[model samples]
Target: MDWDKLRIFHAVADAGSLTHAGDTLNLSQSAVSRQIRGLEESLNATLFHRHARGLILTEQGELLFDATRSMAQRLDAAEARIRDSKEEVFGELRVTTTTGFGSLWLAPRLNKLYEKFPDLRIDLMLEERVLDLPMREADVAIRLKEPSQADLIRKRLMGVNMRLYASKDYLDARGRPEKIEDLSHHRLICQNVNSTQVSAGSTYTQELLTYNIPSLLTVNNYFGVLQATLNGLGIGVLPDYILADFPDIERVLPPSESREIPVFLAYPEELRHSKRIAAFRDFVTEEIFEHRKNLHESGDT
Candidate 1:
């Protein structure tokens, strides 16, 4: 159980080549190979299968690699905690959220955050998958629902609903649907009913389909739906929050909308004291507050 040898083994397993691992670790190829050999000898395990193409991890190597990956994430978390300054917020903060909210909402407002903490480096991971925050897959998450994961500090950010919208041109050309039943004459753009999304959205889409809409465009994510709607393709089912930034898109069938989807901001309890987390949390909270204020002022709420 030599830490140095294990480190070298992890690198080699990761790169699948002695020379590549050596370049990364600043060791000669022979040195790297020697370390791997010694590690295998000490453990009495064949860690990798060597071939002309490259090295592939054996069963033992796969187990060790999984352990090392966890170790690396834990080490990264520790390093971030140690680097946090009392008064300064810098270094990397990894944030994960749904692609729609990240790209359509948070990403656009990040310039204000940079203006205040220019030294801060943010890695925005946008996808539908919920990353393991406690294991440091990401430092923070803004989820569409309250996170079911334990040992995390969660805050309800806001509530969102899937509502109908269309570009002004589309409405002017095709006309707006005054009632839900009138949707039968219009093209409906929305997230696919089978896509991985909040139940509320899929349910809303299902209800819309009951009207026997003749034309439909279904995307997996709201961004795609937003894009098609913006281009005047059809009336799109989208999150109401999008209205704060995309005010030009007119809301259609105002009485028809989805159930509330609660937005939550969550982080590991361990990160509760991290200054970077505090700064990011505050920035997002403030942004949402401002967004709500604007919506109310414009009577869109």
Candidate 2:
């Protein structure tokens, strides 16, 4: 099989138009059409059904597409591995992490790493939703939850303690809630507009108490919640590291009462041998573990 022709087919299928595929592949539309025709003749199957809107994949094309996507991804990974072998910490490192961790901690530390390895390029993708590692959506991920998927290689970074905190102004205005039961009287701020993980028959309201807050103002992102809490909107349940820099916000609850969120550095098991991933994993472990004290002490916990 001609891999080049197969690549052109894949590109056309992806773009849904020969002209767009040609634009992507830096070829003429007629050239792209010729390649597709050649691919169909070679396979002896009609890969696409032409419609007024665009080319729709035939059944055979769908099957071929599934296989081709996998093949292309593996080929790209193989190329990346070879490129990584030829260099020392030089290549794009795509990483996904939560907003709080990315902004407060990881973003700051990455500068030092970049300084040490100038050749390396880093892509920090900050989002609450974990990227799909098995599908190769991201090269690496720093997550708060343990990855249970069999194909992922996960390393525990540290056990992060999440505690309730409030600015002095908010605490003074609403007064302190000495017990968990007293929380009802004060306004609480909840982060992440959508609930984390809803179990069977659970409502949106039910998940709030799971984090130990009932009535509250909810924000869609972590930074919004942090800023709102700092402005004395209400008490917020946040990771200890996030509150480290804000001296005005005091920990409302003891460490024993807080929730322990485990942090993990995860990558696909297949890419475990990649030098870039190994370097990042080791760098994160060394940097975070070595400065664990400062991270903890910076917070009220």
Candidate 3:
């Protein structure tokens, strides 16, 4: 019930050691231990099971920890709202997206954003796992599919398709396939069919594999696939959005491609008024527009 005690308990539970929690809270280990004891006495519950290794949460501890975690997230959200100045776009903005898109596309274009808001701090999280926006796990997300979470604002950023590509040197060495059936003679590089990815990409890879290709190199992510293709290893199944930045790579069997995968940018409804969120949203939207423009001018379609 006491805010300070709850805070201390959360820290101790998180660190799993009184000494470590003391270090974080700027208190002596004895003081932290005293607070924990007091909290347990107040609630008549054993919060942690002491052991040689460290402290493990008891059943009651787990429940209290969950509540404390929720409180911490809400406090963080409130602090973020307070720090978001109406006229200035500065402070940390956490963005999450797939490794392929984040590395190949968004990361490269971030320089322009920095030039505009030199004081802005961005934490870019690249992975296949979808972070929870409403819980403040991340401030914004660019996902391969629509977010089903409630009380969030979503926007469709763009559409992408999985297509075959290889570096000029690789295509020249192995020869390019004129049709889908000709893939039988070439080594195929792609994401592992079982790896976590958009259904469109996985289904496309499966279809390509059905060609009975003799040689194959599978990586769990597209960055690896791109690297292998760049090194003249094999033709790779990759997203079409990569063409804007990597013009040197040639599309193989242009007629063959995957179904369209929708790309969406989303943030919690609570972040609607945050200037940091607004700046980031506009920056990404503008970059996508420019990306589309570049692709059109180059006749890459």
Candidate 4:
């Protein structure tokens, strides 16, 4: 088995498309196809069941892929160890977090991290679905709740509460709600009760829904809800961390809030010594400290 051919085959199989694999490998489609053919001939087996959509691995290909996948993971582990031996934080760091925090909080503050580690590349994956950290789906994760995944080194970064907020202009026009019952006459914006989110947030949203709000705007993510609130659409339920970025948004019915949701930073236990992880973890920790300090000094706490 030729290592180069196997590598190309692995890329093609992983992507499920020749063009995508070619793009990643920096090779032409013809070249990738030729390598796959050569690999098939060398092994005397039809590796892929080709169709109009894409290729599917055959029984033999599945067996070969299992071996190649193990080889690739081992290689990645060896590379991570090699990189950890160096002090420089220069490599791709895949970080995952909720769309709300990643977009509204972490992404804006990443420039400071970049300023320190000028050569670092961050791949920010914003989604609600938890990635498999132990499987290398993401290098690090900042989540609204403590990760339940085992074999992870997790730190509780902070706690955030979901609260009602609206644009100052909107509140000035509609008048602020003095109590939860008063909210029935105003437009309430929040994540859909069915959306994948922290249980605390979802529970709070469900409770608000029972108030018979005159108008409702439900978004799947807080980012959308925030945008709508900023537009003066309605009072939105959002995390407290956003106050640092959106000063114009005023908290409404200050006493109305969800149970505090803990923010956590976690990484695979195997990456305990990784310099990249350490750099990212330290940078995020510093940002949170600064955020807290700013809120205190501004009298916004």
Best by TM-score: 3
Instruction: Give candidate 3's TM-score.
Output: 0.98
Candidates 2 and 4 compared by lDDT, better number: 4
TM per candidate comes to 0.97, 0.84, 0.98, 0.91
Clashes of each: 0, 0, 0, 0
Candidate with better TM-score, 2 vs 3: 3
**Model 4 C-alpha lDDT per residue in residues 102-155, reported as the tens digit of each score:** 999999999999999999999999999999888788889999888999999999
Candidate 3 on 1-301: residue-level lDDT in tens?
A: 8889999999999999999999999999999999999999999999999999999999999999999999999999999999984589998999999999999999999999999999999999999999999999999999999999999999999999999999998888778788898999999999998999999999999999999899999999999999998888889999989987886798899878999999999999998999998889999999999988988898866
At residue 12, candidate 3 shows an lDDT of: 99
| Model 1: per-residue Cα lDDT over 1-301, one tens digit each | 9999989998999899999999999999999999999999999999999999999999999999999988888898888878874679998899999999999999999999999999999999999998999889999999999999999999999999999999999899998788888999989999889999999999999998999999999898999999999999989999999997886698998868899999999999988889999999999999999999998998878
Please give the range of 10 consecutive residues that has the lowest summed lDDT in model 2: 197-206
Candidate 4 stretches greater than 4 Å from native: 15-44, 298-300
Provide the lDDT at 253 for model 2.
52
Pitting candidate 1 against candidate 2, the one with the higher TM-score is: 1
Compared with the true structure, all predictions reach lDDT values of 0.93, 0.78, 0.93, 0.92
Off by over 4 Å in 2: 128-130, 192-194, 197-215, 255-258, 296-301
